[model samples]
Structure formats: structure tokens, C-alpha cells
Target chain A: MTELFDQVRERVRRNVPVVIATVVGLDGSPPPSFARLGATLVVAGDGPSAGSLGDDALDRVVEADARRALLSGSSGLRRYAVHGAGDGRPAAAAEPESGGLTEASGPTLAVFIHAIEPPPRMIVLGAADVSAALVRVAKVLGFRVTVCDARPAFATRTRFPDADDVVVDWPHRHLAAIADELEPCDAVCVLTHDAKFDVPALVAALATRAGYVGALGSRRTHADRVARLRAEGVAETDIARVMAPIGIDLGGRTPAETALSICAEIVANFSGTPVASLRDGSGPIHRPTRA
Target chain B: MQDILDDIDRWRDEGERVALVRVVAVEGSGPAGPGAAMAVSEHGEVSGSLTGGCVEGAVVAAALEVLASGLPRLCTFGYSDEDAFAVGLTCGGVISVFVEPVG
Candidate 1:
């Protein structure tokens, strides 16, 4: 069990996807000796599985469930009948069992399936002053941050040493090339002050499933960009997904404060939490006291 | 569990027995959900946490007991539980933790 746990730790450290399936409960006359309670199995993304849950049939069933859980990015307890007609067969479906301690009819075994996914990516465009701070803040928040810019001089690794990746390329082209890799957990932030860069970059971002698509700009600049987006035939709903004049109404100044707001907004977006953002409020973005 | 790996490895290098505690199920408004884990070394060192620091001391005691008895058991801490006492979580939710010695 310790060896299995060590494998799980290694995979998590390397940001590799893994699933840990542990036999948490057993109810019956008696369980197999090898099927001792708390027997755990660690399954990696593309390698051999470590440990087992005693019986081969039980291990097979749990392994399949672990893979599904890993893909869905969820953890939960699942119960199976120990002596059903088709005992040890693939579970047809995992119904939400009520009461953590409620035992099902016949002998039952409960396995807790926990999936560990790689940290999501935060692709920040422009590599400008704000981008540098945003990259740092996002890294602190456990995101695999990538700083991208069209200018070679500004996008170097030295400028954003904390970022996981520094790519010097046109914003839209870079986003499009890696669009398929973006998951709903990922984010895209357009920090370029220039419309030429922010527009196409946002267009590409909105086309993907990236959960948070934010652009840094003033209200007038966002209005102009909206007109350009409408002219380019981007749908109204898709355009609405863009968080223009991004960041929460933290009334903060400086690049670090703005970066905090943006990262906080991304977290709020994913968590389905409503926050008071500057984009939604009419008052001054920063308080006079701070200035 | 991932957060406490370094400390666990250090303890293991020194050949100390350790108990791993995992939150298997959380009931209603619990602070931490399933898969939240913590480890307690034989030397009484603890790493990670199951809740917002309400029941960790009791959990460490449970871990030491498990290490001494060499037994795996399930312990629950919450407001609605019959055993709710000084060590229950203040969050008004129930969390069932499985404590077992690492082999």
C-alpha cells in the first residue's frame, strides 16, 4: 500500500494524471485475504497499475471504474454487490448511494475512486507588464502559466521566469495552434494593450472551450473591440463570453493588483461564484484613496 | 496526501511507522470533501489536514492508536454523529475518515 501511495505521489508531483482506487468498505460473511480492507491500486495515465484489490475480478472492475473517474475528474464512493448474480461484473452504472454508511443488500464492497489531474493551463497573451504579474499570480494559484507574445524581446523566459512556458508568436495563431488542447479548466488572458493583438487572440479563445477568456482594456477600447468583433461575424453569444475590461472590482492599482483581480475572476468563473467585477460596475475602477 | 508526500518520505527513510488517514465521505456542507488526506508518523509528527483544523488533534490521536494496534479502522467526526464531542468538526457536517497503517 505504501508503494502504491508513493507512485501516486510521484505522478502528482510530475503533474501526471492518476487514479487511486481503494477498497474502503466490505460487507459479507468474509472477504478474500488478499482483498484485505484498504487495499489500494494506483493507475497511471500510460503505464502499469500498482497494487491490487485482492481478487482479480474485483481488481478488474475497480480498474475500469478508476479510468472512467480519471476522465471525468471526479471523486466519489461506489458500492457493488458482492454476491449478485453477476458478481465482479462491470458495474452497469454508478448510482449515487445515500447515507455514507448505508449498506446495500447482499454483500457489498465500497471503493473510493480519486482522480488527480494535471494542473490546468493559463495562457496569458502579450507578455507585457501586466502579463508578467499575471503569470506570477497564476503560478502561485497552481496554474501551468504560459506567457505568449508576438515580440521576441518581450516574450523571453527572463521576462517571466515563473511562467511554465514562454512562447513568442502571433497571439491568434498561437491560440489557434493549441486550441484543441485547451480544456474547460484552462484560461486565456489577453493582456496586450493593442487591438491588433487582442482582437484575433480573443476571437480564437472564444472559439475554444477555455473556461475563462478575459481581455485587459478600458471600457471605450472594449466597445471598439466589440464593434470589430460584430463586424467580423462573431456570434453575439460567443462575443458575450469574452470578459472585457476584466478583473473584479477590487479597487486595486498596480500591475500586481490587476493580476490578482484577473486570476480571482478566473477562479470565480470556474467555481460558478458571482463576484462584483469592474466590468459590471459603473464606479471608478480604483478608489481615490488608493491613488 | 500529495501535499504531505515529502514529510512522509522523510519519516519512512527514518523507518518510522505511519498511519494514513483519508476522508472517504463528507456529509452536508463539509469543509473538505472525499480524498482529503493526512498522515501521522509514529513520532507524533502530522502532515496535511482533513478539516479546517477542528479535529486534526483527535485524528492524530487516532492515527497513533492505529499505528500501535496495527489495525485499520473508520472514524467519523461531525455534528450529527452520536460520538460527536469535543473533537467534532465545528462546520456542522459529517466526515468519515479511513485510517490505516501504510505497509
Candidate 2:
């Protein structure tokens, strides 16, 4: 048990995608209660599950469903039935035991499996001082941060020791290598103002399904970059998705404050909050932080 | 849960019995999201926080009961409660916590 928990903890700490399925609620004759049905299944990529829910059939069904849920990045409660007929089959496969095949008459049990995927990935393009500050802030907010740059000297482990991965490669190429793994919770931040780096990086990042794609630059720099990207055949709609001059307009000049601004923008992007300076807002000093 | 794992692991290594309190849901303007966790050891040592100091003391009391009873429970603290033991959030939010023993 200790070893299992340690492995799950390590995977979670490393930001590896994992699903922990626990039987939270059950109801039926001899329903699996806390003591009888209490079990945790730790499932990861193409790996065997650890722990069981006292029934091999149920574990197999749940593990299969869990993999699908993990891929979809969806979490919710699931229902299953015991005994009656075709017990271990997937919910879709099990024919309804009621009339018209629309319902089941068997003893159904509810399993509230809370599938928690690892923190979303935040890919930072450009190994600048602002990148370092942003990486720290993002990590504190439960993001799996990766720092990428074309320059090896700038993108070293020593510079971004806290970063989950530091890739010394061209931003677009690095993004290409990881595009398939990027999810809706992921984000891309292009901090390199140089068009040589920012243009291709933003172009590639826009191709992914990352929820947030931001670029750091002045308004003038953003306008110039937009013209260049338009010349490169990027559609206006695609270009508009980029949060240029990234971060809220906090008039922040320091790297740390700038980092906060960018982080705040990311949160606002997720929560659908309007991006405005805290100074202009009349609410409390600090709002409840979310991951 | 991920943020407080190190503290919980260290306390467990030191042979301390720990109770874990996790914020499972929130209503209105709560300070934390679901899965926010805090662990309290047998000696009252605490790691992590469920809210922004708004309800930690109340959570600790609930955690002590969880440890003593060896049973998990769902606890709620909010601004509108009239109960004598009510510990409300200054932000006028309601948070539901799950208290369990971490073995």
C-alpha cells in the first residue's frame, strides 16, 4: 500500500497523466460501502492498474472506462450494475434489461470515480528572465511548465531548474514534437519578441488545441508581427486568437510583476473573466485563486 | 492534494498520524477550488490549507474528529450558518470539506 501510494504521488508530482478511481458511493443489496468497496485504482499511460475494487470484472470494466475518460480529460460519476446479466461488459455494451432496451432492471451501483489528470502543460518559448519568473509562478499554480529556446546557453537546466523540461530547440520544432500531447488545459506563451523566433512559434502553437496562446511584446511589436504573420498566410481569425502584448495591462515593468500579469491573463482566459487591471476593478484585493 | 503530498509524506515517515481535509466543493465566492487539501497531524501540526485562513481552525477541529472516529466525514462552513459551532468565511462563501484519516 505504501509503495502504491508513493508511486502515485511521484507520478502526480512529476505531472504525469494519471487517473485515480475510487468507489465513492454504492447502493444495492449488500452494497459496497466504505469498508467493503473502498479501493483506489491508479491508472497511467499504457500501464497496468494498481489496486482493485474487490471484483476483477468490475476492475476490468472500470479500468477500460478510465482510459477513455483520461484521454478525454473528463471527470464525473459512473454507474454500474452487479449480477442480473452481462455484468462485466461496458455500459454501452450491456443491453438494457428493461422493456424497449432503454433501461436496466438489475441492481445498479454508483461509483463516483474522480479521474484527476495531471496539471496542464505550459510551454514557454524563449528562455528570458521573464520566462524564469513565469515558470515559477505557473508551477506554483499547478502547471507543468516547459521552457524552450533555440539557444542552448539560455535554455539550460541551471537556468530553469524548476521547469519540468527545458528543451534547447527551435520553438516551432519543439512544439511540433509535443503537439499531439497538448490538451485543452495546456497553454503556450511566446516571450521571444524577435520575429525570427516568435512568428514560427506562434504559428505552430496556433495549430494546437491549447486553450491559451499568448505572446509578449509591445503594441508596436505586435502590430509588426501581425503584418508579418499575415504575409506568411496565417488567417486573421487564427492570428486574432493570440493574446498579443501578453498579460493584463497592469503597467508592470519588472519581470516578476510582468509574470503576474501573464499568469493573471491565463486565469482570466480560463474563467472567462474580463481582462482589466486590478486597479480599475472595485472588487476585493484578492480573488479566490483557481488551478 | 498534490501540493501537500510532501508534508503528508514527511509526517507519515516520522510516524505521525495524519488526518486529511479536502475541499470538495464551494459555493459563491469561496477562496479555494475542489481538491484543495490540508493535513493535520496528531500533535496539531498542520500542512497545507483549505481556505485563505478563513476556515483552517474549524477544519482542524473537524480533522481531529475524523482522526478520533476513524471515519471520513463531509463538513461545511459558510457565512450564513446560525449554528453555535459555525465558522464562516469572511468572503461570504461556502465550502464543503471531506475529512479522512491518511494512513
Output the number of the lDDT-best candidate: 1
Candidate 1 per-residue lDDT, tens place, B1-103, comes to 5567778889988999889998989887777888888999998999888897988988998899999998777787788666678777787787888898884
TM-score of each: 0.84, 0.76
**Candidate 2: stretches off by over 4 Å:** A1-4, A23-38, A43-45, A55-111, A277-291, B25-33, B65-84, B89-96
Clashing pairs in 2: none
- Model 1, residue A52: distance off in Å is 1.6
User: Model 1: clashing residue pairs?
Assistant: none
RMSD of 2: 7.2
Model 2 Cα lDDT, one tens digit per residue, A21-132: 6554444544433223335577887477888765676778788877876687655556666653234443331321211111334454444344556778899999999999
Q: What lDDT is obtained when candidate 2 is compared to the true structure? A: 0.75
